[model samples]
Target: MSPPMIIAGIVVWFTAGSLLSWHARKNLGEGMIEYFLADRKVGGFISAMTYSATTYSAFMMVGLVGLTYSSGIGSLGFEMTYLAATVILMVIFAPRYWAAGRIFRLVTPSELLARRYRSPMAGAVSAVLCLVMLVPYASVQLMGIGYLLEVLSGGAIPFTVGMLIAAGVSFVFSWWAGLRSVALTDALQAVVMLVASLLLLGFITLALFPGGLPEALGSRQDLLKVSWTFPMFLGLTLPWAFFAVTNPQVVQRLYIPSSVKNLRKMILGFSAFGFVYTVLCVVFGLAAAVKIPGLEKADNAMAMLLSSVPSPLALVVSLSITAAAVSTMNSIILTLSSMFGRDVVRTFLPDISERTELGICRLLIPVITVVCFFFARMQLGLIAVLSSMASGGLLMQLPTILGAFFWKKATAAGAVSSMIAGGLAVSFMYVQGLKPLGHWPPVWGILVSGTVFIAVSLATRPPIDTEDFFSSLEGYIRDSFGS
Candidate 1:
């Protein structure tokens, strides 16, 4: 494919996305609530699209595809498990998060923890942990765009150039009108991601494999077997299983829908989109494995396969990958900034004006982008591992989250201690490349964090408002039932 063809595809996509961003800005409401949460008035369909787009990122096409190519059906099982876990968790917890956000007038999920525990340190610790751990996952999106463009263009576009282009676009979309622009662009990009994936799959079926997938996979039946070791599968799937509750970017989405009706629609719509997209991406990897076998780097399977397709079709598919990466990165930047402002900074000042807080969040967008840009430039390990690593480190939050909602004696000391201890455990293991006793770092992290949370909570006093908080949730449930 010529550089000009790929360039033209991205230019057109960029133009349309920019127009959407500007249009979203026109209707953007004032203040922090409007900027970060769309004033909690987003419609069902848009809510669904934004949630889907944010959750399924460049990871699907690039990282997950590559994992499937190399690891076979086990990768599919891992992702499917994640999908199932996410939906189940959302069903049980989304309403609670939505109610808490409205009841507490919270701007971020971390704030909910603060309100629940009546300890600013609990929220501040959670927020800081997110800011640190989420960077690796965020950088994976930039790395996806970098690898796709660089491989497809045969080095006509350097990886760094691709990373910068993605980062710039993400920053712009998020900066324009906060969540309004981000969500609107996300809705457009989500459609492109789904439609383009379906087209690519159909093309591969008809053009690449005339007979059917089974017929095409004649000699690679072994690829369908679950070859991954028990430890490897457990290490990867554990954090992702709790992703809906742990990952801030997705957790924040629970607060966006206009009403309980819209929230249900959001959950159902995301479930449908997620299942289809996950299948498409996994199949794509399997197809690439059969078409272009034994690529040294599995991450390049999608790129190498694209290079063999028609130039025009390749350009469209490549643009879809770009859209996935940009939409996800921008959402992370937006969500993280909100945490920094509402949870971390406000913890100290306690009296900062809303205008200043919003301004701070907007200002941090590029700064965060630049930091992730540099990290992406490092050419990290396999995309799937890096992404899972981020989630694993974030898995430390699971204990704190559970305690906040379910445990009466869960104290701020327990929350802060468990997070700090669990987070450090994961970080040290990743840095040293250590996996003690065949389990991954997050496996160890959950153990340490959960134990510490229990011991410390039992030892310390519960928050004063624990009863009130629990009662509020029960009251909301009663009111909902009555309505």
Candidate 2:
């Protein structure tokens, strides 16, 4: 991976992404909905791909492998659990969400909260938490881009420079095209990532492991099994089970379906795709661990494995890695900006025109780009740590969001308190050096927050107009079904 080749590969990716952005802006009409949600026009296939790409992000490439390297086989639980959770969301939540967004013309998940709960304050809270969680999560993607560049270029490009270039291009593409641009680019990137994954897997298996992956695995069988004791399993799975329900990025995906039929198709398709992709990633990590033993940390597994391959092959893998980061970063930046402009600013300054709102969203790209660049330079090992930390805090939103759409008895106060208590408890544990008795803090956070939410909602007065929430959502379902 010479400097010129590395630069050229990136230049090609950004150029293609830019072209797609231009096309999106031209066709999608620069409205906030178009920018953020692709005007709810995405069909089954693209939606599934977008969901998988966003969910996988750079973490699967870098962090999953790193985990497989350090923890052995237990990391497979992450993907298996994610697959289970996603399937449930598709079955129970996606159809309803698409309907809700279609009826309300939601630009952000917070806007959905506002409409459902009929409280500007609730919308504001949702918006704040989304922005807070997403920016850092997006930044983690940028950090992966930096890392990919650093590894491929053999340290010729500084990590900061690499992150800036990658995030800068992502921010620009997202700002220009909005949802259309992100979707189109994501579709293309997803293909690239798929090819890259398969090719790299083959290369590593045949080229590196002469006896093949199964043989290599025999030596490190311990790394391939589930590491979770019963308690650990509960801590990890329970919180993550709630994550797909509440995660803004994950739930925001529910808003993009063109029809209910399409939503069903995506659920099945994405569940299969996500399961395969995650399983392959874990396998790659485990194989890498076998090839490159004694890893001090899990996150470095991918990079360490790449170092063993030929430079040119490593470069291809690196490009796929870049695609992983860029694809997710673009989506996150677009979502965060939309949330900021629509959920936070538009509340107090409703007079701000839609055109102005779009402009504000575009302006935020650069601001977020800089922040992500700074974090990319930090010693943020693998992206999984950053993702887990953010996901843990935001996991508190799960029960409340579910209650809003499904539980009629859920009150606004209870929803608000649940989010506050859950988010705070997770943050507190992190700050206080609290660890989940050999598990993650998010596990406890989920339990504590979830219990409070259920108790409070049950104990409190019912929402003033629970029927309004369902009534508003009916139009969406009808429209989706009809369409």
Candidate 3:
């Protein structure tokens, strides 16, 4: 595809997104909740779409596609494991998140910890942890856009320009109407992502492989069997399995549904969407392997396939990928900014006004986006693991979230210690490239964090309101659903 056509498609797509943002903003209300959570009134399908778009970013179409193309069907199992874990976790935790968010008027997942453990430091530290881990993950999105556009446009768009375009769109959508605009645009992006990928798959199966994919696979049928080593597969799957609870961006989505019914719909709807989308991506990867065999680099599989497809179809898929990348980036930036304002800044200045807090969060959006853009410019070798690594690093927070609901003995000190130790463990291994005794870094991180959390809790006293906290949540759950 020519640079002119690629640029034209992006402009048209952005224009449509901008119109959607404007429409969302017209009905936006005032206050922190309204801005960040859309007044908790987003419909089921929109919530599902936003959750899907945010969770499955350019990673699905680009990285996951390439992963499947190179590694075969193990990628499918790894992703399906994540989807199954997410649905199960959602069923257990979404109601608690919704109930707590409503009762406490919370803005960030870190804020939930602050209240649950009765320690601002715990929330602040978790917020810091999120900021530290998620930037690289978000940067990988920009990196995807930079590489995708730079290669597809034959160097006309340039890498930096691609990053700038993504950063700019994300900042605008997130800043314009907060969750309202983000959710609305996410619905649009999700539709584009699914439709474009379907078209890509249809073309590959019907046009490229008239005999069907399984037959075309031929000797490559080795891909049909699971080949990933247990250590390799477990290491990759653990972080993502806990992603719904651990990642602040998606965890925050649990608080957006208007009612328990809508929340259930959101989870069920996401599960269904996830199943189909996951299968499509894995199949696309397999198709790429059959059609573009013997590529030197596996990551280049998706790019190679795009180049061979019709220019119009390629442009559509490319824009969808850009949408996926931008949607994920904006959600991360927004959620991080909210965490900063609510958990980090307020930890220092407890008396800050709502207006001032909202102002600080707004200013930080561009700041975060620029930081991610710079990281994208670095072209780090960590892009592939960055997603899982970020989630892994974030696995530190899982103990705290679980302790919040299930353990009365869970202490603020425990939450803080586990998060800090676990976060450090994950980060140290990732940065130094250490696996430590044949186990993944996250495996070590989780073990260390869980140990610290339990030991420290036994050593320290629970929050003074431990009993009341449990009663309140239990009461809400029982009363709201009559269980």
Best by lDDT: 3
All models, RMSD in angstroms: 1.6, 2.6, 1.2
lDDT of all predictions = 0.90, 0.76, 0.91
Per-residue lDDT over 1-483 for candidate 3, one digit per residue giving the tens place of the 0 to 100 score: 899999899999999999999999999988889999999998899999999999999988878888898888999989999999999999899989999999899989999999999999999999999998899989989988998999998899999999999999999999999999999999999999999988998898889889888888886988898888888898999989999999999989988998878888899889988999999989888988888889988878888998889999999999999999999999999999999999999999999999999999989999999999888888867755565578898988888888999999999999999999998888788878898777799899999999999999999999899888888888998998677
In candidate 1, the residue pairs with backbone N, CA or C atoms under 3 Å apart (3 or more residues apart, or in different chains) clash, namely none
Model 3 shows how many backbone clashes? 0
Query: Model 2: how far is 457 from its true place, Å?
Result: 3.4
TM-scores of the candidates in the order shown: 0.97, 0.92, 0.98
lDDT of 1 by residue, 439-477 (tens): 989899899999999999899998888999999987885
Best to worst by lDDT, what's the order?
Answer: 3, 1, 2
Segments in model 1 whose C-alpha atoms lie over 4 Å from true places: 378-388, 481-483
Alpha-carbon deviation at 371 in model 3, angstroms = 1.3
Worst 10-residue stretch by lDDT in candidate 3?
A: 380-389
- Give one digit per residue, the lDDT tens place, for model 2 in 1-483: 689988988788778878877877788755777768887888888887877777678878887778767776667776587679768766777767777776677777778777777777778787787776667788777777776787777899988888878877787777776777777888778877888888887787778878878887887778757665766566566666766666677678888878776787778777877777787788888787777787776678888887888877777778878888888887777777778888888888889899998888789877877776676566556444555567777777887787887788877677777788888888777666677566668878878877888898788887677797787676666665653
